[model samples]
Target: MMKKPNTAQTILSVASCKMTRAILRKTGRGGTAIPGIVAMKAAKNILAAVSEGMEIVVVTGTNGKTTSCNMIEHALTSGGHECLLNKSGANMLHGMAADLIAAADWLGKPQYPYAVLECDEAALKLVVPYIRPKVIVVTNLFSDQVDRYGGVQNVLQEIRTGVERSPESVLVLNADEPLSASLARSTPNKVVWYGLEASVGTQGNVDLADAGACPECGGEYAYDYHTYAHLGGFRCPRCGYRRKDPDVAVISVDKKGTDGSTIHLQCDGVIQKVRISLPAVYNIYNAAAAIAATKALGLPAQEAIDSLSSVQSSFGRLETFSLNGNRVQMILVKNPAGCNQAFSYVTGTGEDYSAVLCLNNRTGDGHDISWIESADYEKLCADPHLKKIYAAGDCREELYARLRKAGASEERMERVSDYHALVEQLKEEGHPVFLLPNYTSMMELRQAMTQATGNREFWE
Candidate 1:
């Protein structure tokens, strides 16, 4: 039998939020179990008192939590305010607690002027009471982790409970996402909605992957233009329900190839332009959401914009690395809509590269890989530069079968059982590997790579 970790060592090690976050992510067992156990025990002896006049901001979404949290923290820190943050994609109850405990002084005092945390939707219900965030930012609600969350509605309700508990907190929502926009409907708090202008997208039949119905009326919502899957300008036909005119709106978006995007927005009556390093319309909204929430906390618009432009991809979300002399991208794909956005963004450019689609049956990535079938594999497989396909992980066979059903030829595919072996093979071939990994599989693969390369820098 394996021995449990030491209680004091675990708690003390978690003091550096960054180090604790990496330990939890690289500890294995689905990144949601052991660290959580340690955190639950750690929080018992580490209760903290909120400093006077300090603000607490909590950011949550199916995707973009890490990047959003990083941006928010960067803005606050750049503006000369001390910030306690979880920038390593640790968002569960234990991870959140570990971040807080790590941020605490030696005497267990929270010395920061503000705290910004990214929260896992399911974990929010359990941690919100302990953290009592004064500002809650809802990025977007998407179908992810069906096994743990049950479904999208359940995840929404879980986050809603957290938001309702801090009913006095400033609720900043994505006006583009129906579920996120509907969060403050019954709550008695300052609700501020944010979004992008309809003119930014092509004015036609907006291409949407899923969730086009109104959350309030279950009515078919009409879209002025869809910037990305299930996100854009939409209004309900039956109840006259529509996108709330945002207090902060992304008025324009200009793409700059791989460098990033420059977004012009009207935030709190101020017209400001923010440039972000990540591509895709989704990231624009992520930057916009961060700006809106931070603005409410009195952070300057220019500082927020500057911090956003300097941000990089958080781990597997789009973290690019040099592979075989070519820049390879890692865009996480789990559900239908997210897969579609990643697919659309990559394929929309008409550039092609080899791909490694790693899927797993781990708890954090959803034990059932049935959701992968809902993804648009046909479109993904047909891209011209897709030189090869590599599948590995707990559900490798299942993903292999799915790709075969999608008409992938045997000559174009390979399945390696070991992650380290796969990395070695990729390095030998010298071709860019566009890794499409599910949650835990991605972390496991990275852990293996980090160990093999002896480089903690890339893993960060």
Candidate 2:
């Protein structure tokens, strides 16, 4: 429980958040995380104070949090319900605090009845208790930012710690992911499950052979099929710990490459054919997650499923735009799981396109670029439809070496170090261009590309 802050502390906290955000915007900086940091420094319980009485749903995990939150928010808004959401991809404690404070009144009380907060997996414990959300959604976990979180098991424990902190918050878990599904056993919280029942594909260069094991017993898992990565139907021979029958499940999927996918979804014994505008098998999981979460939050299943067809949340991941008279899709790849999915989706599409692979070893992108070796770059390089592979970023040499080793021909590959030069080369491409960049490199290249194309800033 948070201490009862004095009236002065409450006022100061709210003012601090609002003012800091304003200054950040004026100074041409991102106000997402800083304002929350400033506000929390002013009042420790300010987040709880403002969020009190507001119904909330907190989304966390290594992937799909933002998309799931966006879908839930879209469903809520489609039903004429206004809600607060942290849609700027700031899932940390401070970023969430800033969002809440900005939405609350001057006295530190929320002005709305609901909120959909995307909390980072590691930051989940920090924000979950204060919000005590109505629902907590955990998308599948993978090895992301290995230096900061250590490993996948460590990331799982961090999320489990967060979920354990607030047992009153109902959990919406990916039933197919044994690692994330194990949370249901540790916590007393009610679990709402979602995942794909069948594999969209099983072909890839990545080795996930040792990835999913029984969390209860030190036993290996046998999968009936895989939707993506290590997620699918799995049963442990020793402990009998296995995948749960999901409350909302993707019964089947008809993928349309980058255009989108049509999924047959099952909700409360009723099957609904839903069309998702987002591409890839990972997005099918994201859709299932959204439907499960919104349904748990009391929205009609039809409304929740219907809302996804119109949600255009490609704020970076698989976002496409016209640049230099070419159609360029920007997909952010930070971890092997995400990178493999991106590669599989593109290569599987059979589309004639060129690719620009951007690699950066900054803190946000994780200082380890060696993880690219784990990603299935072979699938991407082997695509006969690939007109060329232009390696760009600070680590372009490393990317060039990696792709060359993955069967990319010497004559077909090029290395462009400068962003300006990369943009110019993209102008000459007749085929659709696929731009895959890590976190920091995405930010850097996006600035140049968006400027050249007259697109709005990421924050806008």
Candidate 3:
């Protein structure tokens, strides 16, 4: 049982956070991290006080954190457990603290039995000490927010520090992700790994491989097969460190299309055919990570597997809406790895479609926009089904230039600076539409598109 905070400072912090959150919600500002910041200022230990007595599962990685966390939450709920989550994509310390504080009562007592938090990779170090989660899931490590994290290795170290802080927590990791798998060596936590055992398809060329070198030694790593980027069966010849056989492994992908995929998964020697409601190979990894985490929490594996079939796409990741009798899908892409996967999914559909590329160099998206160049835009250009290409957002010009360089026709390219005008134009087009946007741009464009298309707001 968790006790309420009676200290004067703690009591003051609780009041401040509750009052600020209420005011912000009423003002249409949206409940963000502001209240958490106020609470932390009033009482530095507010997070520790509010998050007590809950089984916490923190999901952190370069990509797939949000989707994976949502999957875990869905699985938990399907199994009849009440859980709280930070679904706003606010994974930093202040935002995390805010969500925890908001989920608690005035006395600073938790309102749920579990918390499935999607934490930022760098912010993990700050959050782990306070929450002391029962399970920590690292989806995968890719070169993301390079300007902020400095490099992929730095991001790995940050996550490693977080795992070290929660020594008693079980570490659930992606076995195919070499950098993520390496974290198990540095932490004494009981580690459970999940990855694909069978090949999904041919490994295509990518512009960058963040995990080319072994973390233990400078020797180049070898891969027996690669699903995408640096994730696969990798082994370092010098240090002899390699991917461990996953406790929960994806044995084969039976049928995969733009709608969803049917896969054969092996969890602890029990193989089951599962259907993941989401598309793309990356989502398969997300499903495996969620199942691994749920199993680690001592939940029924069958319930977790059953829940995957009904899981809807999160905020901006492959979320679809209907506009003017045409279907519009929004796929969030933050880095080259994610962008390439989105490209593959769109092209794989084999249906004629127009594309909208949105890029923003906002603070949340890491001011550096050079990483966009690393994405395989040529794949999109080569697709005969690709009809028209529209570029939007603050970095629209950059995206147009890249598309042209990849062989996009100048006559088919147009720039739409205004999101409203973009949405209106999209309505005029009679073909299926695919919208690709980076972090901040996704938020802005999603709001506009949802409003124009009569879709539910993210907060709803």
Clash list (residue pairs), candidate 3:
none
Question: What lDDT is reached at residue 331 by model 1?
Answer: 80
After superposition, candidate 1 runs with Cα above 4 Å error: 1-54, 199-216, 270-273, 428-431, 451-460
Q: Please name the candidate that would achieve the greatest TM-score relative to the true structure.
A: 3
Please give the lDDT score at residue 162 for candidate 3: 84
lDDT of 2 by residue, 1-460 (tens): 4554677998999999999998998988763688998898999888888889888999988877777788788888877778888766777888889988989989988888889988888899888777788899998888888888898888888988988888888899999887889899889999889988787766474355436577788799887886677777888878887899999988888655677889888888988788998888888888888888887787777777888888776467778789867788888888888898888878877779998889999877788788888888888887899989889888999999999999999999998878876787788888898889988899888887887787777776
* lDDT: worst 10-residue window of model 2: 203-212
Q: Candidate 3, which segments miss by more than 4 Å at Cα?
A: 1-5, 206-208
Question: TM-score, each model?
Answer: 0.86, 0.96, 0.97
lDDT of 3: 0.87
Clashing pairs for model 1 are 15-102
Report, for every candidate in turn, its global Cα lDDT versus the true structure: 0.71, 0.83, 0.87
lDDT of 3 by residue, 1-460 (tens): 2233457877789889889988987887664899899999998888888998899999999889989998999999999999998887778899888889888887788999999999989898888888889999999888888899898889888998888888999999999988889888888999889999866785357433788577677788888877888888888888897889999899999988878899999987788899999988999999999999998887777778999999988888889888988889999998988988889889888799999999999998999999988888988898999999998889999999999999999988999888988898889899899999998899889989888877776755
Off-target runs (Cα >4 Å) in candidate 2 are: 203-206
Ranking by lDDT: 3, 2, 1
Residue 333: error of model 3 in Å? 0.8
Task: Please rank every candidate by TM-score, starting with the best.
Answer: 3, 2, 1
